[model samples]
Each structure stands twice: as C-alpha cells, then as structure tokens.
Target: MSTISGAHIFAKKALLPDGWAENVAITVSDDGHISSMQRDTVPAGNSVGILLPAPANLHSHAFQRAMAGMSERRGQEAHDSFWTWREIMFRFLDVLTPEDIGSIAAFVQMEMLEAGYASIGEFHYLHHQPGGTPYANLAELSDRIIEAAEKTGIGLTLLPVLYQHGGCDRRPLAPGQVRFGNDPDRFAMLFELAAGTMSRLPEDAVLGVAPHSLRAVDEDGLTAAIALAGDRPLHMHLAEQVAEVEEVIAARGTRPVEWLLRNAPVSENWCLIHCTQMLPEETAALAKTGAVAGLCPITESSLGDGIFDGVRYTENDGKFGIGSDSNIRISLSEELRTLEYSQRLRDKCRASIATPEKSTGRVLFEKVALGGAQAIGRKAGALATGGFADLVALDEKAIDLEGREGDEILDAYIFAGDDRMITDVWSAGRHVVREGKHVKGDAIRAAYRKTVAALRMRL
Candidate 1:
C-alpha cells in the first residue's frame, strides 16, 4: 500500500544476513510488513538519502521521561547512587495519574520515532492508583499506555512488570512500592488483561513480561513469572548496583547473575538489563546463554551505574541491545555514543569496542539491532521482506554527515551527530517523522508540558 524509494538501502545489514544496495525501492503492504525490496535503480521520489531499519529500544520506563532533569540535583548526602536516584524516582512517581502517564508516554514515543527508534520495550510497573490503592479497573493504566502507542504510531512491546517484594529476602514492599506491587496470581491476571489490550494494537505491537529486579522477586515468584513468559520475551533487571550485588550475596549466597544463571531457564528469550557488576565468569556465562544484555548506556551512565564489561562480554560472543531506559535523553545515537565512549574511558583506549572485521559504530549498530529484535520477539531490525517496514532516513546534507560514506556515516552519526541527521522515520509503513520532526511532536509535547506543570503543583 506504500512505497519508499531511496538513494541507498542498508538491507539486512544487521549480522543475521547483511549487505547494502544503491538506488533501492521498498514497498510496504497494508498489513505493515515489507512487501518487496528492489536493488535496481529507481526514479527518485520526494525521498532522498540512505534508508535503514530503525532500532528497537529494548528497555524503557516511559513515565520516567517526565522526571528526566528533575532528578539530577544532589541529595543531602554528597554521594549519589542507584538507591538515591530511586528515592527521587519514587517521589516523582507519586503524582502521576493514568492520564498523565499516557500523555508522557506519547511524548516520549514521539521523540523515539523522531530519533530513529521504531519500537520501544516499555518496562511498565506503574500500575495501581497513587497511595498504593488498586484502581476500579486493574488494567486502566495499561490501557492508557496502549492508547499512547496507538496515537503516536510507534510500535509497542508492552512489558508488564512483576514487582512483589522490597528485597531478595521477600520482605514486604515499602509504602512507596504500593503502585508497583502484585503477587504472582495478581500479576498473572494483570498480564492476561494487558495481553487482551495489546491484541487490539497494530500488528507490530507485542506483549512481554519483566520481573522488576532480583531484589524484588523471590525464587518461587521468579520461576512462576518465567513460566508465564512462555515463548514471549523475558526481561529482568540484574546486578545494576554494587549495593544490589552485595544484598543478593548476603541473602542468597551468590551474585544476582550467578543465581539467575543457576536458577532460571535463561536462553534467547531473556534480556538481562544492566548486568553492570558481573564478574568475568558471570559475563562469559551470560554471553553463552544466548540472552541479550539490555544495556541502557546513557541511563546507566546518568544514574551512576558502572559500565558493563563490554570487551570481555563481546569476546564471549554476547548479544547486546541499547535502550533509553529512563528516557532522560531519548536519542538512539546518544545511547550508542555513550556506550562506546564509556568503554573508551574505562579502558583508556580509543575504539576499544570495534571488531577486526567491522568499524566500531557499524559493529555496535548491527549487533544491537539484531539483539533488540530478538529480545522484543519481532521480525525486524533489518530492511528485508517479512520484516516490519520500520526505517530511518538520515539527512545527507547534515553538517556532521556531509563527507561521510558507508560505515563512516554510521560512525559519524553515532559519535558526532545526534538527532539532527535523523530527517525521517517510518514505523510499520507509517511516516511518523519527517524532516527531523515527529508529526505529533509539538502537540504531544504541549500536552506533556501541561501534564508536568500539574505534576509539579502536586509535588
């Protein structure tokens, strides 16, 4: 039903089966899947520049986008860590109505579309009303999120989260966690209800499950949750902070990753978020498991979570994907830049993550795209038939990309250019962004501004 002819197309360039072509034409069916791709030269249409499959953001907390800059101030303690930042998050989350959540999610998804992210794996846990009370309709909040995704035209992977306890020992959830708390049975019900809602979304939408973190679920709860995931993607927060690692050790006699590897049926279906504190053995073991390391480099760096062991993990053939987790900054290029830059700074070497066969940015981009597609259980992350027609076009005339060609374009886009080069984006055959601006960016942002203004009054 739709066609896009471009100067060049990076078709299937994600390591699964990779290549590029010039003067390409891609057609999309009304069902939103790729209909056909032709490599021969074609008459140029209104569209220009290179086209490639856009990346899936493998992890995100959509509501946190509103709290992005608000949590940057120092607390009474001079030091800040994940725990301190969490307290700020708790405070910010206290005032969000389901409507507010929807507005904020739409705003963030719009930003994602503009910045070349076609889909987002939203690790949603903000269920229940404020004050820890259940809403009249348990799935009201989730419906709002699905509504946001529909309005923005970005593909959705709604990862309904299971968060039960406050720590590894199964202590009761704190008052602050009331909104996020649900026992296994209640969580299952919520999951089913959310799934029904997701069924109404565009074909590109999916439903996945997430256990909030190692500290938030007991062994039994985790096992049941994993079983609930079945063939769908299974995501979890793991070993993100030193204190979390210490707590898991004290409570379980092992590090979080070690315990998870031994206990859970982790395979390609799993996406372990922020394995930041793993030992070399743990890192290698995780890599061997075929699971994705759902790395949120910008958010991890912003929250002061330590850098992941990228070199050792990659060497062990690890799969990895990037995300905007907190969405404090939503640009995909910034996420990749921060990921490589973090490695560069840690090892005190330039281009420390590049493979012998590929340039640094090319390798990172390709791997993340594949891993992200796998993690979200989508047939995407490449420009090919049967894949979702999610593509991003970079402006050839952008200053940072003017002299770039081939993989250098990717390098400069990630390393030097941010969102400026992202001239257009299409999600499932829908042109959601044009000329570096989302179609709904201004209206959605204005709605978000109003929502945040009201939230400020409540805070």
Candidate 2:
C-alpha cells in the first residue's frame, strides 16, 4: 500500500456522511484526519476518481488466512462441521513462529485493503510460540502484529485475546490450546504490554481487549479483563456453534447470548462476534442492548455455522458488521452478499433484509460500515470532517459499473462485480493500495508464500 504524507483529493462523486455528493474535495490534514471538505467544486489536477467510504473488517484471525483452502479435504469425522474444522486449524497453528504470523498477517491486511476494508479488528489469540511458554518479550507476537500493521499501513484495532481454559467448565487446556492459555495476572501484564507497544503505532491505532469467549473464560477472569479495558472496545466470540451454545447452557443454565445479557455488562463498547445460533428472543433482546454483532458471513458459511437471523435482527434495529473470521475468502462483496443470501435461503424469499427505501445492497453496506467503525472504535464509517480518510475509489470504466450511480452503483459493485472494480484505497489518509492492487503486493506475497510453503511442508 502507498503511504502518503498528506493529500487533497477531489472525487467526481462520493458517499458523504448524509448521502451522495458531487465534485467533492476532501482536505486531509498532515496528522491523518479529514480537515475540511468542499463539494460541487472543480476537479483538482491531482484529484482522485469515484470515491466511497471503505468499511472496517471488524473481526479477523489473520493466521487463518493461510488455512483458507487447506481445510477443504474431507476428513474422518462424519458430518464434518465447525468443531472438526477447529482440529485442522489447531494443527496448522502448532508450527507457526512469530515471524510467520507477522508475514501472514501483513499479507492478510494487504489483501483487506485491496478488498476495500480500510481498517481491521484483529481478534489475535496466537499469543505464545508452538508450546505453552511465553516468549521473552511476552508481547512478541503482539509486537509482530503491530509491525505488520505498520508495514501494511492499514489502521489497526488490535484485540489481544485472553484464553484461560478449554471449555465453560474450566477444563484444563488441551495440548493444542496451550499457546493461547494465560492466567488472569499474566494476561493483565500482556494487555499492558500490548497497550505500551501501541505507543509506537500511528495516531489512528486502537488497542482493544478480547476475552476469547465465554467457553475460555470464567466469571472472575472476565471481570478482571473487563476492568482492564476501561472505556475501550471489548470483543468476544459468542454462540458460534450449536454445541458451544449447548455447553454454555449445560454449565451456565442459559443460552450463550442470554447468559451474556444476564451476567455481564454488554453495551455499544463491546462487540460480540458470531451470534450464529441465537433464538428469536435472544435476537430481539441482543439488538436492544446497543452492542454490535460482529458477523463473519463468509467464514460462517464456509464452516457450516447456522444462519444468522438477519430479518429478525434488522427489524429490531440491531447493529452488525462483517468480518473475515476464517479468512477463507476475503471479499467485501461476498461477505455482504452471502449475509443477504443466507437470510434469503432461510426465509425462502428474494431481495430479503432491505430497508423500505433502499436497495438490499446499499442498506447492507451502510449498516455494516456504521457498525464496523463502531466495533473497531475508529473515527471511520463516513467521509467528513474529523473522520479518518479511509476511502475506496472504484473504476467507473468497469462494464458492470458503467452508467451506474448512487445505490445502483453500490448494488452492481457488490452483487455484479468483485474487488477488480476497486482502483485505489486509502487508510487514515495513507494511500496504501492503488490500481486495484496493494502497493507492496508482490513483496508481501513473496514473504507469505515462503511462510506458507514452510508450514505446509511441516504439516
């Protein structure tokens, strides 16, 4: 990605905070925030083309990007599902070194920028090395993540996860789970170290805390982690699978979402990832809590997780955002398209989950962008004064997008086209991607290839 010192951009048309605007001139300050705006103005000599506010990738486990196609083989487990997929993932991570994580994460972030995500909430949990022991720096892997963000120039909301036990019953961690396990005191130190490492990051960076999940954390651990987060965003996995939901119920005497609502303080500052198996009552109640549902439609579909009830969720005004959780495929269009298609498949309907006044595509994109920014705790989601200049420019020359404007353009771009339509991307005023490719695409791809090849040979 291209990193710019400062920029004055003029878009032929742009999606503004309120709605679309024509001949928009955006002034980006040296410190990387949008300082001023001028609409209906003549194009500057250095003006950019058709611009849209890029959405944030609110949830990701970057290491899994390497395992995208690796898990497609049919295994011995009959009726293979999310739990079976986890075994393969565990094996893959067993051999990953810190350097490999940094390279792989950089590649993933680079792909994200080209795919039209200007920011990422990295739900990073691969804390230690292959074994259960911590590295000398303690935050070695966390520092590697920061290095990847600095290398890629994408705005980062790093969520250092705390994984204590293996299950809701506080079972001892299995051998494969050792790397992610940490006691409350060590986790506190790691969290503080992660926060300290952020001082070297760009101004737009955020450091959030993730208490891996209800299965991995006890009441005391969750409480301690929450106190550490203060006002910053907190994230967790919730009811991603039926077995997990049942396990929570068996141990906690309630459904996973219901348990969180009853026992904890969940608000807009918290992002609950993958509410894939929630009941209708849980859906309606969770929506009213002002928390963001971090939906990973592509990954969820790939893993055979149950469909999220978008129809019920939207009717209750629930906030939601998309994530490339498994990173099997990183496509903004596919994620949003799959989200709608899942609802359609479940409801036996066409053009499902849309606002009365807006097309399905426009409504979904706007909702995700707003919710994603909120989830990542970034000053993004819109192109306006004081917002980070995280913008994506589409090539109007693409045939699918030709003669398209307004919501129709968004519809065509998302439904009819892929990332090839994206000509350039900017994150926090830095031009990191251009001509529909990351500026350092080749170098990052080379490093990722070496890492993946080595890991695959070991496996």
Best by lDDT: 2
How high a TM-score does candidate 2 get? 0.98
Give all candidates' CA lDDT scores: 0.85, 0.90
Per-residue CA lDDT of model 2 for 242-341, tens digit only, reads 9998899999999999989998899999999999989899999999999999999998988898898888988999999999999999999899999998
TM-scores for the candidates: 0.95, 0.98
| Model 2 stretches astray by more than 4 angstroms | 1-6
- By TM-score, the best candidate is 2
Look at candidate 2 and give me any clashing residue pairs: 1-432, 1-439, 2-431, 2-432
Candidate 2: C-alpha lDDT: 0.90
Candidate 1 collision pairs: none
